[model samples]
Target: MTIRVPVVERILSANDQLAVANRAQLDAAGVFSVNLMASPGAGKTSLITGTIQALQGELRIGAADGDLASSLDADRVAALGVPAVQINTGGTCHLDAAMFQGALSCLPLGQLDLLIVENVGNLVCPAAFQLGTHRSVLIASVPEGDDKPYKYPPMYRGVDALVLNKIDVLDAFDFDVDYFQRGVQALNPDLAFFPLSCKSGAGIEAWLEWLRAEVRAYKERRDVPGNSGTDH
Candidate 1:
């Protein structure tokens, strides 16, 4: 008397449909969206906060903080005076395309050059959904161990960039940087990797420059054909 579920392909097909529409919406607004995924205590919030501060006066940034129950991160980002939105997923584990479209409705899309969605802290679940982001950045901290990419292959496989955070504490832990890079390369050979320390603000300049170039490129590609002289 057990009910049988359908195949995994069916579930993925449904998710993919929603992602298509989400991409259209973001594209129409000419905004470069990024989905940030990581485990708990991996410094997702700190990295995001640091990004906002570092990119200030240089880029128009918007953020959406996703959490199971709390809006603390959203509050902190809002206090930074940027346009930040909070999406409480209740008992849900991760955010999908529909959730992002709903939360983004309250944000001023046209005013944003970059939109960063902080997905709920779960390595396995969050990577399965696509929220119309142009890219996905996966954060794996030192305390989480360097073997994360091998153990959570799906998470590493889906992202465009990898942030190896907590480099300042690498000496305190038994993690090997070379080994970690090798493991990640096995899955995503060309994936951009950044070793950063949010606490000490080390190794942040390169990442910030990369971010700036991405936003600029997106803007250039989206500009009107006849209005090439416009700069904002």
Candidate 2:
């Protein structure tokens, strides 16, 4: 365990440097990106599909999906008329900055107004790697239980925003919204929270509005010299 510590540290440090370079590239192109992390079946693709369907006319969106295998997620996003890239992790649990940088090269970054990278489906490892996105959002579901925040504190603590998907089933499931939100509040007090259902479109408009505002704010900040705001 002790010997493995520094190796992990070195890997993450290298990833951080690559992430900085990735961010610089995105900033130069004036593109806003998001790193979306969630457990398997947490509706990461569904959320992406829904967002693209709703914002298709307004925003030029792109997606990069990371998975252990298969291009299904990428296909789903591409079918919506958005440019999609697939990053096969080849059995890796999460995506690193290097993989994201490569995907960026394949994408027309300057032509895109928004980019969302769907990280591999895991709660733990994705939180450790910095992918240089403007924001990192995590999706939790009604069926995933409210104890997730307590169990995966690092994932909850690291994200800039939280999305509670599958919310349309709240009445059928024995989930407590207050308990989940409170648990998240303990770890990240100022975390942006969005409770929406990709299936039913419940509360989706609010999420969309927030996204529009964020993009507008990011664009406004670009004109200010030496703006120190952390987009993530």
Best by TM-score: 2
List TM-score per model, in order: 0.92, 0.96
Candidate 1's TM-score reads 0.92
Q: Residue 21 deviation, candidate 1, in Å?
A: 1.6
**Window of ten residues with lowest summed lDDT in model 2:** 223-232
lDDT of 2 by residue, 107-179 (tens): 9998998999999999999999998898999999999898899999999999888999998899888899999
- lDDT score, candidate 1, position 119: 95
Show how many residue pairs clash in every candidate, following the order shown.
0, 0
Q: What is the lDDT of residue 207 in candidate 1?
A: 79
Model 1, global lDDT? 0.86
lDDT of 1 by residue, 156-229 (tens): 99888989899999988989999999999999999888999999999988778878887887777667575422
Clashing pairs in 2: none
- Candidate 1, poorest ten consecutive residues by summed lDDT: 223-232
